[model samples]
Target chain A: MNENRNNLKLGIFITLGTICFVAALYLLGAKQNLFGGTFEIKAIFNNVNGLQKGNNVRYSGINVGTVKEIVILNDTAIEVNMMVQIDVHEFIKVDAIASLGNDGLMGNKLVNISPGGSRSRTIEVGETLLSINELDADEMLRRLEETNKNISLITSSLVGIVDKIDKGEGPIGTLLNDNNMALDLAKTMTNIRELSFQTASLSQNLSKSFNNFQSSENTIGMLMNDTVLAAEIRTVVDELKNFGTNSEKISSDLNTIVSGIKKGEGTVGTLLSDSIANDDIIKSIDNLQKGSEAFNENMQALKQNFLFRRYFKKLEKKK
Target chain B: MIQTKGQFQSAKRFLFLVGDIGQFTLRFFREGFHKPFEWKEILKQCGEVGYRSLSLVGVTAFIMGLVLTIQSRPTLVEFGAESWLPAMVSVSLIREIGPVITALICAGKIGSRIGAELGSMRVTEQIDAMEVSGTNPFKYLVTTRVLATSLMLPLLVIFADTIALYGSFLAVNIKGAVSFQLFFNQVFETLEFSDLIPSILKSFFFGFIIGIIGCYMGYNSKKGTEGVGKSANSAVVVASLMVFILDLIAVQITDLFYEL
Candidate 1:
């Protein structure tokens, strides 16, 4: 009787434990599409990489099934078969795209399916899912390498430009480097300012001179009241003219005498016709040429000398 | 002379320990497969280890789930992901907490009991008497006990996980409300075969270690009554240690395969 009671208690415990186990199994298995109506779909890939069977299959981010098997078709291609729940099969279409992706930032591989074209027909059972290869890490690294090369080239060009700018190698460089250009600019500005001031003063002086010219209290104005003096001046002018004609006749006689002297007609003429006179004239002309050459040499010497330069500067200041 | 005798005795004891445990494990495997199976005894053991441990496991699981939910609430709120609580709790419980809690309870309850009972039997020579009789003591004792623990613990874990999720649902309702249907849907929705299988499988390993360690220590006990106490104590300690070790190994394997 005691054994029977113990057995019964044990039976109760066992039954309860079994029930719990079964319940848990049902819940967990149900979630895995084990107890549900599901359809299978196959997909072919160039490379499955780390993907495995029992990985999730999702459509538009919602998990619909699990990978059932993975097979190698050739050296390059892999085939993945998935079991999707029947209820979600309608979402699969004739042109649905299947690709490998990770679950989260840190998660296992999953098969993600993109929705097919709206105009396309729904997918039938036993039909293959179109496979897409994502931009994997290696491809991303290759792009990064290209980008880095471009960046380096750009940076080197920028450095070269900066070096040229620093060394002042172009027109802008001359503008920056030349001290004479700056001095010339300053001198031109100063001269323009002084010229403007002088022009203003000259305009004022000219206006005053014109006003003085128009005034009646001048010597030119007294000449208008002296008509009788003007008539007496005319009589004196006629007498002077007769005397001027007599002087002209005597001058002409002198000119004839000079010509006879040149011919050696008289005692004075001999002296004028001598070779010593011609020699004396030539000597004077040579002296004049030598003096001019000496002047030119002196001027050249003066231009070369610092003292002469100072004297020229003083002359400029006086001007 | 005394030292030499003592050394020889210690060496003998060590040999006996090895021999006894080896024979016990071998007999357990053999009897596990043997015909005219002791289903009654096995069921009884399942009751003691599985059903009886449920209340304690359920309470602990509930509290664990409640605390995990409440603690995770603030962080989830910060992320504006309070909706993820049900799924998160379910995954955590299924993957780790459920198996560990169930195994721990079995270790404390079933492990100590097996050790103490078998230890007492050893000290009293009752086991020897059974062996001397026409009955096979190993089949009657070790196999049934080991089978009971191995089968019961996984079942217990499943129950514990279910109750814990219920507790988490209540916890979620403390500051907010999620419909029971929605919560359960979310819980099952986020879970996959990967999460379910690995956790369930690890519990069997936990059960095996708990059973074998308890039986080993108790079966090879010495010093009569004092040995019985020591056996019970050591069984709990060693079983708990082995549980942690097995859990570590299971986690590594699960990570290698599931990668989740």
Candidate 2:
């Protein structure tokens, strides 16, 4: 019984030890993806930061694989080999880009593989994954310095503009500070307004005077407004009408005489119809024009022969 | 007169302690490697130390795992890390609780037995007879008992650790929900070779301390049966204290190496 018991106890210890070993193996194997198919891709980076060989490889936030190896290519560049799940092979493409990213702000760093576009060709086994290096610390600091300088300049310019406004030193200042200019403008506006008012009053007065003269209310108003001028005009018109009637009779007699002359039956008509009579009238008119011209010239010659000057001198002495 | 008296008393106690400790250690080393290997005796001791103590260790480990899980829940929840229960429990078991609880149980069970048995033999003149017969009394007595404890305690710790994890599983399902397989997965996933190796290593130290202290106390016992009882009680006390001390040193050493 004791011997059997001893055997049984030994058997138990061995079995427990085996169980522990198997359990540890299973855990390690699962982590290494031993039972699953996987594909490999490699990428080259200028820096790996803190990325390690066993660090996770996340594709679109899902942990699809882990880093297999990391090698320093040069002083400045590193090459990372990753084994991705075979099932996700279709999602990876030749143009797929990889970037080193941290798990969180303070968490471990990992490699992040961006899903390539559908249009891109599927990546083949052992193909090198494209890598994009993040901005180096020095470059980032340089850009930050440039940005800060620009901000400082813009702020200083803004301060200068604000100072100018505060000092009231430009067109805006004049508008704000010059009260006399405002007063002058106000005075000019008042003068124009008064002149317009006076002009309006004067027009009103003129209209009143015209109305007084047109209305038959007083003597002058009556003379201007009543029809007395019309009566005088009518009397003149009656006299003109009588004159026109007498003229008409005289014109008829003249027409008869002219016709008799044409027929050579009256004295005036004979004179008009006779050629000798016409020539005598023309000769007389010519003689009269010549006599007038000669008299005017003799007067002028007599005045200029000192007689006009002597008379003017005698008249001046007497005055 | 007073100073002389105190000095004399101290000297006597010191001599007695030395004689007992020396004899126990010497016999332990001797019989441990002697011919005839004491396989039967070892088996009987193994049953006594390991199998008989199973229920007590199991019950304690189960409650320990359950209580630890329950207590840890609110704290982990505060950090929003409730899912870390399995990993956290496994680490605690492998590093701290597994070795500690196992050692405590052994101190209570095995340490007292070794001390009392040896002390009894010393008082009863069994040790004197074996010495007279040239059988090497300390060798037969101290060696086998110490060897049994040293070997058995580690095994017990291993069994205790396994049971503790199971207890943690049951505890996990009490107020929370985690499948057994999944719990074990999470536990093993976070547990590395470092955790396993260090914990297993520390349990051996615990066993050694228990064995040495128990055999040392019992072999040096005096004052007949009363001395035997006193030694047994003191052995349990000292061994338990040693367990904590050794655990502390183990942790420090583990940390020093592990941090690198």
Candidate 3:
């Protein structure tokens, strides 16, 4: 009986140990989503970024599956196969995007899946999903270096512009810094003030002159205001009109006489117009000239002769 | 000159001892398979080595877990990762600490017990009597005890691990509140099949080394009653040393298979 009891205790101890082992296995397996209806899907990536088999696959921040296999297809690409729960496969659509991500800032690498749009159909088993490779540390460092260079360039240019402004080198700088221009502006303002004062005085004088004209204090004002003087000036203008009418009549008579003379109806017209009379006049003028010359010669002879010389001298002396 | 002569005699005896132990292990393998299978002896051993040692193993495991948690708390708290206490304790205990500590305890407890018991039997000529009575003494004695220790150590380690986690759970609640479900969830979440399988497998090796060392020492004891005490003492020393060596090799082998 003691032997049997000992065997029974031994059996119970073994059974309990076995149960604990099985429980541990079940817990670990369930955590990896092993004991479930699952579907397989593949994704191809340029790089897995150190993702390993048994890494979690998450959708919408919830773990849905685990990476089952990773195969390097070529030098540039890799194929990752994931075993996902069947219930979550509905949330993963045909056009869903898969990418590598970290569990936390410094945690394990995992595959993150973004649910597809409403237009996409639900993903089927064995379908290949799209994958995006995460940026490697080297690529991120390179980008950071470029950004640092750009920031330094911008800061240097800004510093140069600030230095130039401080030295008063541009239009804005001259406006801020040139003392001569400010003085010139002040002088011009003073000149404008003087000119405005003179112009005000001139306008005041013109107003005074206008007031005098309105009060009939000047000739122009009296000429404008005296009605009798205006009427006398009108009579004088009437008399000048009568005189102009008489002069016009006399000018007409003179025009008639000039027309008759031009028609050769008078003595002066006959002398001017008759060619025979013109020759007779010319002969008479020539006879007169000859006679005058002969008379002048006789007179000269008389003055030079002894008998007439004395009488001509006495007449000259008396004159 | 006398001391030098004595050193040289001791060295020669040590080499002879090595050869004798090797021969005994080889003979165990030879007789182990040709056995009139000793199921009754193996079962009785299991009761003694596994069930009877549970309280001692349990107390040691609880202290290890409690002390590990209490000690590790300040450091993790400094990093603001106090919540990770369960996972950290679970992984450490399951993967390395629990198995090794339990095996060392067994090496001291069961290994020495087996060594002394067998040494007494050998000195009393009980083993020779069995041999003359037309029975295989090695097959009946060494094979059953070795098999029992090998099988029972792993089960004891599993029990030790469970109790250790419970102790850690208690320690965790001393300063903070955590639900049993959440703490266990965190523990299992951190534990992987690789951590568990390799550790349990190494415990088997630890058990085998303990059994073989104990049986070899006792089965080949000399000098009568004085030899019995020496066998028991050397059995523990060699078994405990062999446990560490095997643990190192096991870690290397596990790393080669899993890490690479």
Each candidate structure's TM-score, on Cα atoms with residue i matched to residue i, is 0.63, 0.58, 0.70
lDDT of 3 by residue, B2-45 (tens): 99999999999989978887888898788887748888888898
* The TM-score obtained for chain B of candidate 2 when compared with the true chain B: 0.89
Worst 10 residues of 2 chain B by lDDT: B136-145
lDDT of 3 by residue, A188-254 (tens): 9899999999999999999988878768647877777778878988998999999899899999998
Winner on lDDT between 2 and 3 is 3
For each prediction in turn, the share of the native Cα contacts (below 8 Å between chains A and B) that it retains comes to 0.71, 0.06, 0.94
What are the iRMS values of all candidates?
2.7, 3.4, 0.7
Model 1 agreement with the true structure over B1-260: per-residue lDDT tens digits = 99999999999987986677677678788677978687777777776777677789889989988999999999989978888899889999989988997898789888999999889988998889999996676677777788888887887787788789999999999999889999998887778767878987999989988998888788877898999999999889878988999999999999998777
Model 3 chain A: weakest 10-residue lDDT segment is A169-178
Best first by TM-score, ranked: 3, 1, 2
lDDT of each: 0.84, 0.81, 0.90
Q: What is the lDDT of residue B139 in candidate 3?
A: 89
lDDT of 1: 0.84
Local error of candidate 3 at residue A115 (angstroms): 1.7
- What tens-digit string does per-residue lDDT give for candidate 2 at A177-246? 6788668768988999999999999999989988887874786677676688768868999999999999
Native RMSD of candidate 2 (Å): 21.7
